[model samples]
Target: MRQSSLTGGAIMFTGYLLFFIIMRALGLLEVVELRAINFIFLIAGVYTAISLEKKHLGWGFTYFQGLGAGIEATVLGVMPFAVFIFVYLSWIDPEFMVYIREHEPLGHYITPFMAAFVIVIEGCASGFISAYTIMQYVKAHTAHPHE
Candidate 1:
């Protein structure tokens, strides 16, 4: 909704795309375990957005503001990445889809849309959690308006 959140989301999106491309280039895209590392990028991006918003608001920063910025950044960052994944699996390389399907619990039920949808859900939850946790430290250091 705000510039800081948008910028943070952009950073997260860029990192997600770049990392995926790098993994694909290295032929390690299939290494299921390595995907966990993407969470770090997500956390970093959310932190950046919330921190920026805090600075912008100065002593006016509030819990809700941080939460919104974090969630907005996460959604903005993840939506495009999910689309990219959907496109890649659906058109660029159906084999990857097959690979993912085979590795998933309900292998037969998995689809490109499902995969992308999962990312969206994960991103939103992660964003909320990340924001809440980060706000603990930030709120502690910040001078509350009521104070």
Candidate 2:
């Protein structure tokens, strides 16, 4: 489980990083339109991890196990990205931070720490919801005979 989670997390992190770089290179990083689209990778990562767990467990996989795996993968995967965001905002491009502060819908300035916190919180929430939703299908298909 640990191995799969770590591997899946790495995969997720890589995918996100790649997309971020691409978006930045294309000068679309600050475009709010692309933000939601990036979430597809996040969902893919969690789903991939849970699917791998299911494969490993074969016929005995359970909903809770899938949920746990998804959560673990999401946390591990998003941590690196969160750190990167902090560093990027703090050093690489403080102007982006200023832009965000100035145009934020909430009308609140976000520090680097706040940005990281929001990322983690959002990732965890997405992970939890995705895990629960995905596990419903797994649970239905893998239910035991006695149940």
Candidate 3:
């Protein structure tokens, strides 16, 4: 992987993990309640990813560049999440379907695909905001001690 890719991935993953633990500790990880929080973390993760990417790549964050970076980070960051769901919900969670049927029943309403689709939608929203903000921040900051 490129330097920016590795850095962005590491930063995004670590940040997400930390936020996950904190939210879980605060009892806000109840899938239903934490949906929004997860979105926020997505943005934050993207923001951090872009920041690190810009620093490593030494590229200015033009609109297109930022958008591309955000999308890349979002896709990479969410890859693990998708795999996790597969493993946990399909292979590990003994009560995955039961819990889903009870808490997020959708056959009578929305389908399971819709529920999963929400994750991608939320990721897009968060990624856009995060990329914009992080790029702006990096653009504004100057005189780095290391540089």
Candidate 4:
């Protein structure tokens, strides 16, 4: 279970990073604002966590248990994402503020609290979705066990 969780968390982080990079290259990264991303994470994370927990524990979902798992996965995913975002914002785009201020009207007024909320929501949703996907795949393969 622990191994699966770690693996799933890693997969989620990598998948999201790749997605972000692709979106950035296409100049659509901003479309996934922190808040919207976070909201998606929360919804996906809950479902994934529940599915994974049931697979490992043989029981249905519990809010506390699922939340704990979701948070753990979220933390793992965030550590790398934080560094990635910092690198992109700082070294990659020192002039990002100016561009954002001019092009993105709301960029200057975005608060730290808002960013935090978005990150939290993103982490939760990503974690859950990853977990759910992992479980589904595992179950499908197991059901059609190879000789």
TM-score: which candidate is best? 1
Largest lDDT belongs to which candidate?
1
lDDT (Cα, tens digit) per residue for candidate 2, span 24-91: 89988778777676477777877888888988987677778888888898898889989998999899
Q: Give residue 44's error in model 1 in angstroms.
A: 1.1
Q: Tell me each candidate's TM-score.
A: 0.94, 0.89, 0.64, 0.56
* Pairs with steric clashes in candidate 4: 38-121, 38-122, 41-125, 42-125, 45-125, 45-128
TM-score sort, best first = 1, 2, 3, 4
The lDDT, on a scale of 0 to 1, for candidate 1 is: 0.89
Better of 2 and 4 by lDDT: 2
Evaluated against the true structure, the overall lDDT of model 2 is 0.82
- C-alpha local distance difference test of each model: 0.89, 0.82, 0.59, 0.55
Compose the digit string of candidate 1's lDDT tens values, residues 28-83. Answer: 98788887888888988899999999999987778899888988898999999999
Model 4 C-alpha lDDT per residue in residues 1-147, reported as the tens digit of each score:
454345445655665677777776888755736435544443343345445764675534344554466556666666566666656665676565446555665877643344444555666566556545554554454432233
Per-residue lDDT for 52-137 in model 3, tens only? 56665564434456456666777777666655544544565536445566666463353334444655566656776677776676
- The whole-model C-alpha lDDT of candidate 4 against the native structure comes to 0.55
Where model 4 places Cα greater than 4 Å from the true spot, the runs are: 30-46, 59-63, 104-147
